[model samples]
Target chain A: MTASSASPYQRLHVELDARRYPIHVGPGLLDTPDMLVPYLAGRQVMIVTNETVAPLYLERLKRTLSGDDRDVREVILPDGEHTKTLASVERIWDALLAAGFNRRCTLVALGGGVIGDMAGYAAACYQRGVAFVQVPTTLLSQVDSSVGGKTGVNHPRGKNMIGAFWQPRAVLIDTDTLATLPGRELAAGLAEVIKYGLIQDAGFLAWLEARMSSLRGLDVEALTDAILRSCAIKAEIVARDETEQGQRALLNLGHTFGHAIEAHQGYGNWLHGEAVGAGMLMAATLSQRLGWLSSEDMARVETLVASAGLPVTVPAAMSADDFLAAMRLDKKNIDGRLRLVLLSGLGEACVYDDTPPDMLKALLDEFPRA
Target chain B: MTASSASPYQRLHVELDARRYPIHVGPGLLDTPDMLVPYLAGRQVMIVTNETVAPLYLERLKRTLSGDDRDVREVILPDGEHTKTLASVERIWDALLAAGFNRRCTLVALGGGVIGDMAGYAAACYQRGVAFVQVPTTLLSQVDSSVGGKTGVNHPRGKNMIGAFWQPRAVLIDTDTLATLPGRELAAGLAEVIKYGLIQDAGFLAWLEARMSSLRGLDVEALTDAILRSCAIKAEIVARDETEQGQRALLNLGHTFGHAIEAHQGYGNWLHGEAVGAGMLMAATLSQRLGWLSSEDMARVETLVASAGLPVTVPAAMSADDFLAAMRLDKKNIDGRLRLVLLSGLGEACVYDDTPPDMLKALLDEFPRA
Candidate 1:
């Protein structure tokens, strides 16, 4: 194995036999390019990033990929949730084809969750699925979107409404990219970071509480370690249940409520992390109402989110009915019945169907604008 | 087990475990919807067919399905290959949502390869993969497209340019649909039947030579038995190599050349089988020119294609170079090198790479004129 492959973090493999790929994390790994070389066996490489991320490190990324064999190219998509549409995916396909790319090509996603999801979905559908590399530049993508094989473009009816479960050939989480991100974006990303703790990693959440300031300040070691821990946990969940029949639902700790808030707010109004941040708070409160979580445990979640600069309050204009209607439209719902990942305790969640809307709506009112 | 499931045919499952699906062939099976009750698992059912099919047998299929406990609905797509697009897939999704169909709902693709492929692709993308049943209603679909889980829409650049290998929960091949199919379409379907014999079943090809006339007359036992044999050979091949990494390429038969013809003639201009029909003749001739096939073997291929009333000659308007260019753009091309699946013996074939373009251009010129 190359020195680049032997990192301090644990590496998990999703074995589809030859299509297998690895998830790598930990500090001082991004600057090292050798780990990425083998997967880039094909000569041409297209780096897909967005406007919000391009200004910060596109040049440095280009430099790392500079080699005689590499015909490096870049396409900077407009940054936002709105850009995750078929039109954008077509644009990427057009560029790859115009660049003389065939099946033997690699597409590199170089942004946060939206960029990774869209680029990975394009990779999944392009020529009936090709190789893709994820270089996540945000905390949400590093810990969540980049690790799982779930990739897709969205429909007006729902988020990730159209897509495939195409895993990336490799994921490069350069925590260094965290340095220049907008503070709100950082806060939004932290909501996802906290989610790993809520869904399947309580200890990780506690670690985030003690290390929030270091992460926000871009202390390389702390952020890298946090991302590595998150990826390892997610990789285990995905390996056993790639199709999300059971255990995988736990990963959606705040997403059922989070997606409703994002859709109600018209996608871009709230960062995914922001809606998820506030949504997790609401879910925790509902857990308390159900006698599942203790009041003391709920207070701990609120304190951790606040210290990480995440929001713990829902927007004022939104009403409980809108949240319920939006939740009904969530992709997670089965047979028109709303199914949610409700916590029985921290580090555990069960997907409960037959959620009585009135009870949910009534409890949803309890967390209103306090 | 039902009497049919206990047959030697039924015990031979596709056998990919979770991705495993049974291909039920024989007459009267469509009316026996009881065969499908177990697979439905008490979920809602949506039958996706086309105008060509719905007018003929929708009520009967529904009556058969009425025995089940779940709700049954129908979505009719426009007939023909032209409708295999992202636009068409959106309609499936919209229909499901408008009808409040969710994850637990099972989609039954109730037409030819177009319906099976597009519906299967729709299921793969719907909520990031849902369970789908392939109720293949064409001779071509019964043998080939229905068995392999490869599903997707075409990109503007090529045919089947976008898709996935999302397997079915089960495939119900009702032989009765073949009786109502036009003779021309039935002939087109035979191209795949002939492909099986050409690839690895010389004895089956010989059997087809003897029974082609009976099959043409829609003799139930002869044609149904032919289809069962073809699907069995394909199912066994696909169960081992679902992704086309190795042995699966042998299944391509005339497809390397066939895809070029389909794309050059503009998909719908020629039925997929018509293209394969002509393409197979060209492949045999190319094999002869490459010093692989004897004169008698080449003659036998042309004789079978001619008897099926399918085109055994290329369109005069498309030049050899144009065909070559189209083939290069095919997903089958690897690392800019052309890979042609060539015949070695009467029934054995191999994927040959870096094929000589001049040889192909010359053979294109020497094909039998209509």
Candidate 2:
């Protein structure tokens, strides 16, 4: 870990051997050309963002990347999770082809997780893989999506049904960009921030519990510290299991249940982090039922999630069968068995495949609905 | 290298460290479950073939994979190079998801280069990649496409413009399948075989020159030898440069010109190997012009290609500009420079980014057209 003295930004490397890359977290990092330029494959750069983010940081990024010898272009797609699809990615490939971009060109994902994922996937397949950089603007993206190279689009059947683990050349997280984020989006990001603490770091969890109000209040120092810790934990895990064969699956502490909510509700209905927030609560409750976590532990999990401004209940219209139907299709399952990441205790997670069907059904049936 | 004494099949391994897998080449290997069963990730199996091959080999493959414990499903896509698009791959994903295939499932690609590429890509992105096996039925695929892990779909703008380097768990080449192949398709496959000789093996070139008639006549021994040699060369190249960072580009001996011919003619109009046949001749001609190959060497190249039943002339409708336009989009090029693989000698190839535009144009304009 290294923080530049001139700027307040801290840097962490995701050590993937030959493909190792750095994640820089700080205020106004996007405007720093020195942060992004070294990672670009060549002079041809394509900036992929959404309509919402285009008006926010697009020009500033362009100025930072612009030079006499470099050719930089931008493709602004419609915003929202609904827009994250192969067709939209095709548009990015089309723009690259139309511009006659070569194999050395770099794709800079300049928005939230949706943009980062689609753009990273586009880079993954363009000319059978090219270089890409992640400039995640949303708090959720800065803390999670941008660090690991899990890039893909959602299929109608599941979330991220199609994707590849193509690591980016660098991740630029500008805490300053969070200033323009909606309060709900900010809250959704805190869900993932809280996730890091619950899964691996009890001390970080206590720290976040203490500073949750300050983070929501947009205190720069508080936000930067939270982002750095989140990225560090994620980067370390990714370095150990770049392909998610074993220990890395623990990071999906809330995703299996969360994907069910996102899919049943239709993509983009509930923001990814928001669904994950509720899903974490459901997992904790289930853990308590399984005798893994006590009721008090479950309460602490719920209070922290709720205090972060996330929902703590399932959608009213969803049935236990709906959750079962969707969870069965999760990517984590193996050989028709539902494999889930569950909490063994605070700051510790384990994958369980033996959760009794009746127990799960009872929990789903009895859990409060929003 | 290991040859099973019970059957006449010879098995060679592609040494990719942890991802290393075996390539079994010989007749009737497809009927042996021992070849494929060990490589499958789990009990869920999806066989992806095309309409043309499904009728011929799908049932036989299913029978080979069938067991009371295994769940087998098949998706038969329409045949042809033009059908190789993101849409076709989407259909494969839809089938897997509809079948409730999970991360532990395996995809078996059972067709020509088009089917293999599409299926491999589908597996590459389906749940961010699962296990896959290559059961290539075409002569072109048996010795070339199946051995290297280059999987992708063609974008309208370019060939294999979207894809990933997802290796298969195994590559099973059933020589018996070629008994039903069209003569022209067989000739196309021969083009790639001849390419192996031209690019990396002088001894193999001499062997091919002597055995050209035997190979064309479908002498099982000659065909098997050729396939083994080609795969051996390809597997070695892929292992050294899995992602085409350097030495691997030499394998694209005639691909730059071949791709231009294919793209201008519209993908399926000219078979990939057929275009490559003509492209190889064009490369040799250019090499001769650059004083890299003597006139005698060029004549040997032309004689070998002509004897293989492949077209050595450019397409009649394509002009210099047409070739240049498509070649400009070749994936091997970097930073707007046109990179081409040219012969340093009869059996050795080199990548040259400094090919003078006028010399290339002159060759394109003067090359004989069919």
Best by DockQ: 2
lDDT of each residue in B46-118, candidate 2, tens digit only: 9999999999988999999999599999999999999999999999999999999998999999999999999
Candidate 2 collision pairs: none
Cα lDDT, model 2, residue A299:
80
Writing each residue's lDDT as its tens digit, candidate 1 over B1-370 gives 1124565234346878667777777677777866666666346788889999998888887887775367888889999988888788878988877776677778888899999998998888887877788878889888889988888887677788778888888888777788898998899999999989998899999999999999999998898778877888888788778877789888877887778777777888889999888888877777777788999998899899999989977777777777777787767666677888888867878888855767777776666554
| Model 1, total clashes | 0
TM-score, one value per model:
0.94, 0.98
Instruction: Report interface Cα RMSD per prediction.
Output: 1.8, 0.6
What range of 10 consecutive residues in model 1 chain A has the weakest lDDT sum? A1-10
Candidate 2: which stretches are off by over 4 Å?
A: A1-7, B1-7
